[model samples]
Target: MEFGLVLQTDPPAAGVVALMRRAERLGFSHGWTFDSVVLWQEPFVIHSQILAATERLVVGPMVTNPGTRAWEVTASTFATLNEMFGNRTICGIGRGDSAQRVAGRRPHGLASLGRAIDAIRDLAEGREAVVDGTPLRLGWVRDGRLPVWMAAYGPKALALAGRSADGFILQLADVDVTEWMVRAVRKAAADAGRDPARITVCVAAPGYVTADDSPAALAHAREQCRWFGGMVGNHVADLVARYGTDPALVPPELTAYVEGRRGYDYTHHGRADNPEVAFVPDGIVDRFCLIGPPAAHVAKLRRLRAAGVDQFALYAMHDARESVVEEYGAHVIPAFARP
Candidate 1:
């Protein structure tokens, strides 16, 4: 399986560039960032720096929403980057989340997201597409290529990803949930008369490598990565509201932990010490994140790969950012290397 590194585009843009450079040197093929512009810097601006600094790292938002920018503008930015960087960029997009909510808006509906995916891909790839009843195309884009990956957590979104998107992005790493979602996407693809094997499945989550399975070590690891459960809960809460905690529709392993979720504070969105995340439990953290030693990570990754995961994007958001990248490069990544 391929490996990718996920980061939030915090300030000191150089630091973000440095980390992407290091990840590329250590064998990460993709570099992703959170695209909530209000909470963080503009990822597309930073993506330019990352693309210029790294030799082969494909970079884009872990997710950008369709609502935040005009579809043509989004396609133009990506096409521009691909023009400069040899098509080394992928667009991982979602309906909306922190990017929209923090700006006092709700996420665009699934219909809009689905249309945005097609319009962006077509325009970026130098094809003409209709956006809002107008024929639009990036006239400058020649031989440009952008693979649009959709991030989805609901049935409609998953079906849209399968029917239209080039790939699927699942933001958590639970093997059971991974298996279930992969099946859903592929089945959707097959039912839509698309080749299921052509779709790439990426499972992204925080990966905190611990020294050992000792009680103290494990606790620290969990604490560092627990924020992920709350981050994911933002989406799960939406699912629960719509799907009504039905296990047949949405797996209980996903919807169960958010029962205690009261509300989320975007101010502490993806931080480890977010006060709002107290509702997130340790069990949820363990299942949602990769929190043990390198061997343990490899074991879970093996299971994930068996479940049709094409890539594992490590969200190095905790204390040991560099070390975890090094550990994965030295231990976890090599375990999956092809001869």
Candidate 2:
């Protein structure tokens, strides 16, 4: 199994180079950057400094909306980066979020994404292919081709990514979703004349654990939820609508449920919150985040690994919670990194 780090929004650009160096020293294999201008500098451009600073650390954008850069220009940009770095370039694509709104393009559907993947792969692989009847070609050759990762959620897009991409990024999925996507990707790979097992499945989720197990842990879980509580990512509203049979908006029970559990940790005294309990109804936050003692957290991660997560990208919402950026580099990583 592999582990990766996510560079948060508002991270100091000045310290990015140093952070990359520290990550390298800490024995982390990869540093995945999120693409959000409102957060800070553009992920790809910021990654340039990081790529220049470190040798072994694989660095790339976790996701960049396709609307911002066309397949041709995107190929050119990443190919140039790959030339400089030799083989450490990954291009991840996702539906336009707020970043897409900034660029004034609507989110893409599964068909659009499937087309984009074909076009981008064509450009990255140096193939003379026509996308949507547009003849496209990247003249430059890439002896060491860059990997392409698609961040997808819906079944259609997941299937497309499964068939086409070098890897897939799962943002809001639990072990169940991750398992489903991995199986889908493997089947897609087989259908595309590629080895299904070759594709990487990177499971990303919120993880923060405190050795003390105090009020701070509960507060940390609430703090984490405050952000996720309102995250209306791709198909979120749709999933909630279709599945939210008894929408919380007009429930028989009072607002007491949200008020109480909204601030409760998913872990109760080092044990997982009862999945049977309707704490949040939707199971959105509870499924993906692990906030508890380190032992319990690692045990839950073992279950995720058993479900086929090749790499677990621990998303640290509050750095103050556990200082995993240090602890992972110190304790957790060494144990996992060993053969």
- Top lDDT hit: 1
True lDDT of residue 284, candidate 2? 53
lDDT of 1 at 276: 79
Model 1 residue runs over 4 Å out of place are none
Please estimate how well model 2 matches the true structure, expressed as its whole-model Cα lDDT: 0.64
The TM-score of candidate 1 is 0.99
Worst 10 residues of 1 by lDDT: 271-280
Superposition error at 186 for model 1 (Å): 0.4
Instruction: Record all residue pairs in model 1 with backbone atoms less than 3 Å apart, i.e. clashing.
Output: none
How many clashes (backbone N, Cα, C below 3 Å) per candidate? 0, 1
Q: How does each model score on lDDT?
A: 0.92, 0.64
